[model samples]
Target chain A: FATMAPSSSPVHLLFRQLFEKESSTYTYLLADLAHPDKPAVLVDPVDQTVDRDLNLVKQLGLKLIYAMNTHVHADHITGTGLIKKQMPNVRSLISRASCAKADIFVDPGEKIHVGNLLLEVRPTPGHTAGCVTYVTGEGEGQPYPRMAFTGDALLIRGCGRTDFQGGDAHELYKSVHTQIFSLPRETLLYPAHDYKGQTVTTVGEEILHNPRLSKDEESFNTIMENLGLAYPKMFDVAVPANMVCGIQDSHA
Target chain B: FATMAPSSSPVHLLFRQLFEKESSTYTYLLADLAHPDKPAVLVDPVDQTVDRDLNLVKQLGLKLIYAMNTHVHADHITGTGLIKKQMPNVRSLISRASCAKADIFVDPGEKIHVGNLLLEVRPTPGHTAGCVTYVTGEGEGQPYPRMAFTGDALLIRGCGRTDFQGGDAHELYKSVHTQIFSLPRETLLYPAHDYKGQTVTTVGEEILHNPRLSKDEESFNTIMENLGLAYPKMFDVAVPANMVCGIQDSHA
Candidate 1:
């Protein structure tokens, strides 16, 4: 029942999934572990945990070049602004479709590089007009099992509520099928929020088990429309703050 | 600033970290992805989350062979009994020193094999008399960055309280240094619980930043002794329940 792996490669990519409790948000710290310079990026960081994230960055001696957001969040403030203040060289990133201010606005098919790692930026809107999922892999060649940072576009056994902020059930459904489901079956999916404390999921599992996404288009739309979830408590405050990279208008 | 990873290995080991929010306990699910059988194991499962854990196991198409514990916990009950009740083939495992009822009594140097992945159990007592740390890697030659599942012997930037259940500060300190800290610098550490939302740490980071553990022996003991922590809310019920694999006298 036990055997040694015949072939293995040295781990060159550093991936750490950090959580923010107040918002149940996941902030990813990705770095090039093989490179001495240790270039890194933080995806979808929350405002409250900025200190912890930065401390981790410093402890690891990483040069964080980007604090990126998958989209404008309606749940909690982004840590991008706070991070930028502490580490001025760290640029803010967001999707161009987001209509939000950021240091760099990316579009579909753009490639984000952190040292030896590659994050293929693919547009996966519908939960919001601006949401994008970041997939890891060198686009054309090398069929490594990739990981997708699917913000709110897709969740574990569920999808995001498409009731507000330019929400559309049809768009969300189409986006997941075309962009996310098209990835390799073994691709690991990491979402921004998980209220149930689950950390990661695979594309294969989601296609088979995701309750909402697995349904027919009509049934999926019906399920989305009838979720009856209440208005998000932080929607008003978080959306405006996140618009300017999580710095409130008064402060900005 | 970006370069393709020179070499890479196909991922054959499946690792997922699940959480139970009530007590901040972490349950890990590990499997062999390269094997056709997909043999798997669950480490430190919680009682209330058994349904979710089993559901995940089913969804992943994994053959759960073992439900193991690092030690008998004082915070929350274990899901071993319930899981046994559901999956008759799955055996319950615990350290022999725990003096707890389990189908398999593992020792300090025992290797628990789940398909191709191997968990080399190493004694890491101090948080409790039976605490153990499971390190993953072939025992020799393979210099791969391993992972240590260090129950409460270590937490992110902190160590567990050594006040009860045969807890000892000195023993805990020596165990962490000799067993966990001795691993490769990049070896990732996953604890049984985390009060903060932090998920993983590395030996290098913990060595430099762990508050209590980074200190000399005397300072460490002083910090642990004067934590002034209140009695655990679920200690009385949980400890006894866990002594019999989380099934109470009435249930048994």
Candidate 2:
């Protein structure tokens, strides 16, 4: 009774979770099919899969209102710059704290509108300084409106590390608890990056089963700090490119 | 008497075949240990492995003289630029026909000397207009120098396609027969790239078993034209960057 999905059209909440193999990034395309224009929003577009994502949008005949990023990724170049170049009117959005130049600097508690749907921002930084989780459709009238685009802030059974650029374990814990875990227990969790092939989870599942962050804040800090991660191969290239919205650094 | 591979110093020919997983590329590192100063030459160092290669070079305490290429690749960025940046004295060498801006524009019959070893250029331009095989140790009074860096022109039981970038089937067939097959049957064939986990082959084995180019010229042309090859994904990004000697095309 809550789902606004029309009987005539099955694509009510038109959604696609696309994957780019190189960086293990998941790009989310959400469209409100109830509206005639089919206004859409894209999250975490990867530069390498620009054509792939654009083709999907074109095939769906959706007017892309915004191309958003959860954070300034250090693993792959973002497709925001390229998407804006392709779709002149599409606004590129990222957290104001990310320092990444985009068309719109989104802030915590801001709502990005696409047709009748709204994406609410919850600052869940820790993977990166500017990380945020985009929550949508949590009102009384939608059955499946509770979904979170949890950037690198939260993974299926894991959490983002606090070792790279501006990462802090304690802050991440607070952010996750107050911002993400505080959401409805059944809210679907969709992270920005996943390597283990597990795609979606829930806030309750993460709170109970997220091996890395389900522990105490101190333990989470210890684990995040001791990941012994090699600097990502694309770190040098991705960081600079992402700073300018995925444009490669010519000066480098 | 000719074989200077003494029992005391078994490092007569310091040889290592490295693999770059992203591009499925093979890099050959050859150093002549007979001389007091171990002069090293690297063929096809990939961009991602620059640090790894540099660390290896540092660990070995070897003086790198030349960073060469079999051809300008269309798969991965070359490490030539990074190598040059790290080792200012190292010369970057590729075929003059490649139009790649490098320190040395090597031509057919040119010998690149590294301590006591020499890399002789053999024009093998079937794979690409600028493709060339580097043959080392084909002269008298030299022991253990019968090896060929065949690039993509000749692979293990296969040959590169004559589909793009000035590729010519007839030229490739003739070049392989005269330049590569004319070498000693026992000559080791080290290709620039391989996919099936094949590390090395021999002139004798390839000449007899090379399914694509072993037949007559017409047969070779037929196979080359009908391979149904997809243009490499990195063609656009790699070609321009390789032309500038492996620098990433920041403008792209």
Candidate 3:
């Protein structure tokens, strides 16, 4: 059986995976192409690429509805605030647990929709206390295979570092096992950042090959503890700015 | 009308857009997931990222039948030769007009198929005499709106520099106007490279917004001539290596 409906289906969804070079972040643009208005949502947008992203949304004639973050990022500022400023009609969204400023704050199990397309928010806090995975195909029956936008919780072949931002390796391991891995084996997993050029991975691939998360919980926690990673260069500037949806002092 | 079939269709195609950071080149992986064996093809692979590409193919349990190039790239070494060397069963492919060494040389109007998915070759030479665009959804009632893998001939809001490697402004103008702009308005265009992190654009969007291509032929040519862009940093090493399918002196 096919994992998702064909592009010719009655209710087709338009999807694009955009990249931010500076932070190696992946932002996703999605909408119901079948809808008359083409209402769209952007997930994990970076502040630096706001112009490029907004221009694209305009070029495609998509109505920008939401600029959302999977978590409060420490590596790069979120584009949500900047986006809302330029387009006041646009709303900023973040997990309620994130304690961040946004027009809309969602909690675990909440369903966010633009047209018929939906994102089911699942808390997957590991890399950060408020990180969440946005899984597609929630609510009634959506034929598409679920896609997990695993913010910093799960990465390709690796999980995010759990050294700061209230990160807990144990929680992350549990989150992935319960919320992400349990999806259908074909569920496509897109991470927020990738140092390598890889764009996407699948649940089956990660289950069999994820170097860190595939290990037992104890080993996974131990691995996360000894990563010896450096503090993120942009942490100081990014976190505070992102706390208020990336407006920073300039907005004041 | 939807641009392509939805993902759940009986003959759903699996697609992933991979990036190479140094050159901002985009490599596309395509396969017919509906086929039991899942034969796959990679377009415009880069040598520096061959390991990641091959590993992905293996991870997906895809049998990669061909490694092809849209043109002999001047910006980076083509991964075709290296890919074939690693997977002997995989054939290297390039355009016959490109004067490049490859196991399979395709010409305009030819169709290459892996399972039921197809790429209809369209000569889009401009950046170079051999450049071609691989357009999907060709032949016999393929319901998907066509997608053009336009290599350097047309980029998002831009076109490739027409200053070297047999570059010709006039030819590019004519090629895109006749072969690309004429496609269905909703057809998606995937370029070989994008520096600004854009993943894709539709025919309608590019037709109206491409700064150079949207202008008259004479004006377009003038702009191309005056780009004043620096010669590509990799031109010296990339051109010769790409000519022989990216296996440098070491491959011998």
Q: Pick the candidate with the highest TM-score.
A: 1
Ranking by TM-score: 1, 3, 2
TM-score against native, each model: 0.93, 0.49, 0.92
Backbone N/Cα/C clashes per model = 0, 1, 15
RMSD of each: 6.2, 19.2, 4.8
Per-residue lDDT tens digits of candidate 2, residues B121-202?
A: 9999978999999987655534453889999999876888778878999999999999999998878888887665445667
- Model 2 segments more than 4 A misplaced: A1-252, B1-11, B139-145, B247-252
Q: In candidate 1, what are the lDDT values of residues A1-252, reduced to their tens digit?
A: 024221222226778898888889999999876556788999999988999889989988899999999999999999998898888899999999999999999999998877657788999989999999998864433225788999999999888889988889999999999999999898989999998989999999999999999889999998998999999999999999899886563366
TM-score of 2: 0.49
* Local accuracy of candidate 2 as per-residue lDDT tens digits, A130-161: 99899985664333638899998888778777
**How accurate locally is residue A137 in candidate 2, as Cα lDDT from 0 to 100?**
55
Candidate 3 structure, TM-score to reference: 0.92
Supply candidate 3's per-residue lDDT for A99.
Answer: 89
Give TM-score, chain B, model 3.
0.93
lDDT of each: 0.87, 0.80, 0.86
